[model samples]
Target: MKRLLTAALLTLSIAAPNAFAGDTRLELPLQDLIDSPQAKEAGIDGSVRFYLSGQAHPAVVSRMGEDVSNKKTNGVGKSDVESCRWVALSVLKAFQESAKARGANAVVDITSYFKKNEFKSPTNYECYAGNIMSGVALKGTYAKVK
Candidate 1:
């Protein structure tokens, strides 16, 4: 009887996992994520600046190109906001690395590109937190700035 009950509960949970943990749509501050501890640990610095969509940035001496980072997010024991911040930081680090690889010093015109849907915001970026796996998708252009 105990085994049967456990099995049934498991099936129900698998069928409707969102009922237990709903997806959260968050528009968190772009600067806050960039200033997070994870970003600091990743060595993200002024060496490679990130300018959000619609934000005024230094003139691009050379436009390296644009790219996207759909970084993975593991909730673990942290809340949606916490997980989102970490994921966003990871995405930023990825972009910074790419900028370095491409001989660029800045990642500008950053946007939330979840599912390829561009969500432009000068101050905030979009993150989706889910029961299975949260994520932050960022699209940005790499450039050498003035």
Candidate 2:
């Protein structure tokens, strides 16, 4: 009887936390800052979408000049590389936060993009900036299986 009681208690302890595992949704950018205790208990998985925008000072263009000879002088190319990193990082953070909210342990199928035909010329000078928009979507079930 004691052994049976002990086994029942252990089972309850293990199963209690997983009882609440379910589909979750969230929107935030705090993944790196916090840890989700429920992730393991709830059996979580997730995915993220991201976007970024960037601008380059006139100095960038001036430095390159009209030197068609320079393969790297492409105005748009320079701005995208310079600013996309921060944008991607921010998007990643948002995805993490979403996963935590949804009780997801991790994210998959992550995708990113820059707004097409979304370039604008500086009104005053030759400065240019690129705009990027991103989104994160989570899909999966939460459960602790053996």
Candidate 3:
């Protein structure tokens, strides 16, 4: 009976909803922001292109399989790299919106930040780990060539 109760409790815990369960919508420039008479008067009718990039330090530990030290382990886990990717995507979306707001047709010269750092768990576990930071940056000016 105890085993059954434990199983039931575990199931309930796993099924519980997360505090932040919904996917966030990407922020982009609205047509109204760029299609204003003021924007047209300001010579914002041209296309503007930009690029963005950034990086972040490793902030999580991922362990896979019985041999955490084995580099060839088939375990999959989260890392700072994943976080950076998300950040980059967000930045790119923002840039796109900004360009649109300025009446730019598109962006160019995009790049991303990249690096590797050593990481150790805070719990003082003598485990092997790596850190990575990623970034996105934009370069280009808005012009009214259109």
Candidate 4:
């Protein structure tokens, strides 16, 4: 009976998960880097292009940022990376919307800041203790890469 009750409790725990996260939409200045005219000329009207830090680009139009944190209470035995990936995706979506609105062809110099990313921060242990993962802060420069 004890084992059955324990199993039922575990099942209940796995059924419900909770987390606290946030989203930020930013308006960056990428006018000179890839203006509408320039973007149109370069055929860079969409968000398909991306350039990381080391990649070369014509110019920097603006800077954009988005931060997201995710947690899974039921994910005690699950993969943290997987849980964090969802948060990353949320950040990416935010980035995409802002970039598209600003007519940016790509996001450059993208960086990731995760919760529990390093031992120096309390989030690392807090995430483990609370069965929560947080902070997928992604910031980047918006530019035309064509």
Using lDDT as the measure, which candidate wins? 1
Clashing pairs in 2: 44-105, 49-135, 49-136, 50-134, 51-133, 51-134, 52-132
The better-scoring model by TM-score among 1 and 3 is 1
Q: Give the least accurate 10-residue stretch of model 3, judged by summed lDDT.
A: 66-75
- CA lDDT, every prediction? 0.86, 0.29, 0.33, 0.45
Winner of 2 and 4 under TM-score: 4
lDDT for 138 in candidate 4 is: 44
lDDT of 2 by residue, 52-106 (tens): 1222211111111110000111223334423322333333454445545654443
| RMSD in Å for all candidates | 3.0, 22.4, 18.8, 11.8
Arranged by lDDT, best first = 1, 4, 3, 2
Please provide, for model 3 over 88-122, each residue's C-alpha lDDT reduced to its tens digit, 9 standing for 90 to 100: 33444555456566555444322221222222221
lDDT by residue for model 1 over 32-134, one digit each (tens)? 7677677788678868999998999899899988999998777768888888888888898899889999999999999999889999999999988877567
What's the residue-level lDDT of 31 in candidate 1?
A: 85
Model 4: per-residue Cα lDDT at residue 118: 25
Segments in model 2 whose C-alpha atoms lie over 4 Å from true places: 1-79, 113-146
Error of 1 at 68 (Å): 0.6
RMSD of 4: 11.8
lDDT of 4 by residue, 25-126 (tens): 222223232333544444444454544345456565555443233323333454554444334445545656667777766776654333424222211211
Candidate 4 weakest lDDT stretch, 10 residues: 118-127
